[model samples]
Target: MANKIISQRISPHLWFEHQAEEAAKFYTSIFPNSSIGRISHYTEAGHEIHGMPAGSVLTVEFTLDGQTFIALNGGPLFKFNEAISFLVNCQTQEEIDYYWDKLRAGGDPKADQCGWLKDKFGLSWQVAPVQIAEMLVDKDQERLSRVMNAVFRMKKLDLKAIEAAYGEPVGAK
Candidate 1:
């Protein structure tokens, strides 16, 4: 068969010590329209540089919510940090709660703040309401401040609380 050209301009690549396949599977399971794509194994040809045993999983290509991603078993040379995070924009409280609960499982509870959580894989994710973007950019400074304050007070975002804050008058307790 002919080669399939990748239509995605850019794909996120995840580096894991040894759980590339596992992580891909976990993420694919959580997101709709997701699936595992390709699997590539290491060979003895580059054993010196890669250090992985021959026939070991080297990379796994997966898709999450229609976005393609590559997971590489690159060993402990690097680690995931909060410098980069995936923002999951949810349309409802249920959506936000679902993603927050699923992604935050076995994650660092302390790292959770303002809808941000570090998952079991050390990957940071922002589970937030889709309307938050508009709320933050609202023309009213007081409304924006209230919304931001509400956000700062919660780990898993509560859409109702945020909307209440947005509707509150300035200086109203």
Candidate 2:
């Protein structure tokens, strides 16, 4: 069989200490239209550099919500930080709560801020309502400020609270 071409222009690559497969499985389970793809193992050909067993897992390919990603067992040379994160744009409070609960499992509680959380593997994720983006970009500066303030005070975003903030009197707390 011939090689299949990847249509996506760019795909995110995650480097894990040893949980590439596990992370892939966990991520695939959380999102709709998600699935695990090809998995590749380390071979002795590059064992001198990789230092992994010949049959050890090297990489796992997975898809989440139509976006492709690759997870590699690259050891502890690097770690995930808040500098980058996956943003889940939810349409309702239920969606936000669902994603927040699922992704925040085994995550750092202290990292929960403004709808952002660091998962068990230290991956940062943002679970916020789709309207939040529109609110942020609204031409009404006062409303925008209110929405931002409300957002900053939340760990897991509450769409109702955010909407209230946006609709309240400009000077009202």
Expressed as tens digits, the lDDT of each residue in 1-173 for candidate 1 is 01344578898999999999999999989999998887889999978997999999998888899899989999899999999999999989899989999999888999999999999999999998888887787888998898999999998899999989899532344
Model 2, C-alpha of 111: deviation from truth (Å): 0.6
TM-score, candidate 2, is 0.92
Q: Which tens-of-lDDT digit does each residue in 1-173 have in candidate 2? A: 01344567899999999999999989989999998888889989988887888898998888899899989998888999999999999998899989999999999999999999999999999998887776787788998898999999999998999989999532344
In model 1, what lDDT does residue 18 have?
94
What's each prediction's TM-score? 0.93, 0.92
Q: Can you list the residue pairs that collide in candidate 1?
A: none
Please give the CA lDDT of all the candidate structures. Answer: 0.89, 0.89
TM-score of 1: 0.93
